[model samples]
Target: MNFKELGISEDIIQVLKNTGITKPTVIQQESIRFIKEGRDVIAEAQTGTGKTLAFLLPIFENISPNINTVQVLIVSPTRELAIQLTEVAMKLKEAKDINILAAYGGKDIGSQLKKLKGNIHLIIATPGRLLDHLRRKTIDLSKLKTLVLDEADQMLFMGFKNEVEAIIKETNKKRQTLCFSATMDSQVKKLAYRYMNDPLMVTVKKEEVTLNNIKQHVVETTDRRKQDALCKVLDEDNPFMAIIFCRTKRRADNLEVALHQRGYNCEKLHGDLIQAKRERIMKAFRNADIQYLIATDVAARGLDVSGVGHIYNYDIPENVETYIHRIGRTGRAGETGYTCLFIDPKDQRTLEEIEKTIKFKIPRRELNI
Candidate 1:
């Protein structure tokens, strides 16, 4: 359904239309009403499902441009996600007077302090940086009307539970809370139960997860030969664009070097890189200047990139859910996508777990190249 029917403002609607987003995704459709009504909500949906807009629209709808003292606070797990959210918020607020700020570590805190000195209606931040500001009393949440925990599960995974809780305690208790997570695990539930006030839980179950548009395949090979296998698969598949998932930062680094030496247009993303380099890499990847992006799990989460033609698991993920998250990067927006999984004999058990989790066995293919 159109966002206008879901109570989005005409100005925002026009902005979204300009950006070619006329229709609201399922998560946005189901969660907007509750948020507009100022109720605590726990929204569970997969990545690329418009969860960012779901929480963001209602915040803008309820925001007061005149009284700017950080009316809305959005906490994310990573700097990239926080920056991405701010970009989307700025787009939605085209020509509007709302002041948006993104606060995260690995940047200049002094510059952020300068921004905070001015009027800010919305602050999108990572938990650690937000906590740092809160401790120093530099940014006030006393005027906050809404608090959003974006990618709640990831934040908890990154050991931000205490920091998040501290941030919540600093805010007004009467404020509206929205927790968006990919999975409603026990940690997510515990956080909700402790802090949220009779929250409404909206979940999309695993059975309803759709990957029909994606063509999935497996290539059996050893760790030492997996890089060669990846090269063979890319040659055969000839993807428009691809992301290669590695298990560690070292793997991503080595793979990136190997691919570059082979004269492939490639880049690597992991935690070790500085923020400036990371942004440069992301920009190049988005512009299709880089055909292959090798990344670790933490570096790739919550990235907003469309038209990814292939997802390669150069190293099998540790868990079934991770496998799902990795492949979910492709096959977006009804586009046909491909996934090539490289696995060794020891990974057979992990492969079975993934099959059991997704409720189907991925077709096996031998790479004769």
Candidate 2:
């Protein structure tokens, strides 16, 4: 069904149409009614299932107008996700008037404090940084009508349980709560029910959706010749924007350095860098100042960017889920995308497992170089 049938306003629906999203995904279709009805919701869906829009659409639909005293608080696990959410919020806000602040680590607290003094109706933030604001009394949550925990599993996985509890305790007890997660692990469920007043659980599970839109290839190469193999593929393809998935921070760092020496424009993203630097690099990449981003899975969680044409697996993920998630970064918003996965002799077993899980034999592509 279309978003308009789901009771979304013409302005928001028009903005989504401009972005080329016409139909509502299953998660969006199921969760929007509950959110609009003012029920606490725990939604479980896979990556790339359009979970962001599900909560965002309803939040915007029910936002109390013109009060401007932090009516909504959305907690994210990572800085990248927070920024991405802000971008989405801005799109809807542009259609109307909603003052928003993205509060995360590595930003200047003084600047955030100054912004807090303004008419901010919503604050999208990371748990630690949000708690810091609460401790400093720089943010007011007394008027908060809604609380959203995006990527709930990741927040708990990243060891933010205590910090999240602290933030929840500070918010209005009567506020509506929405927790969105890829998996509803027990911990995530406990958090949802503990603070929520009789929450509703909704799940959208479609295993084949991740592989539906992307063209995938497996390249056979030796471990020592991987760098050269990657260069050949990149040179031949010349992608618009690509994401290279590495296994660790060190590998991403080393791969970026080697690619740069070979006259390729790229950057590495990991937890090791300070948050400010990560934000700057992401901004540059998003603005097309850079064409390639080499990053670990943890560093790229909840990363949603449009126009990503290629995904390269420099290192095979440990499981099928991660492999699917990596490929999902491309082929977004109904666009066909390309993926090239380099496999060494030692990686054969892992490749076989991934193929088994997806139930499709990834075709082998040979390079003349």
60-89 per-residue lDDT for model 2 (tens digits) = 888876676888899999888998898889
Clashes of each: 0, 0
Give the clash total for candidate 1.
Answer: 0
Candidate maximizing lDDT: 2
lDDT of 2 at 288: 78
TM-score of each: 0.93, 0.93
RMSD of each: 2.0, 2.0
Error of 2 at 208 (Å): 4.9
Instruction: Identify the runs in model 1 with alpha carbons over 4 angstroms from their true place.
Output: 207-210
Spell out the clash pairs found in candidate 2. none
Q: Which lDDT values do the candidates have, in the order given?
A: 0.86, 0.88
User: In candidate 1, what are the lDDT values of residues 53-124, reduced to their tens digit?
Assistant: 899988889999999588999999999898789778888778466888788987776775686576889889
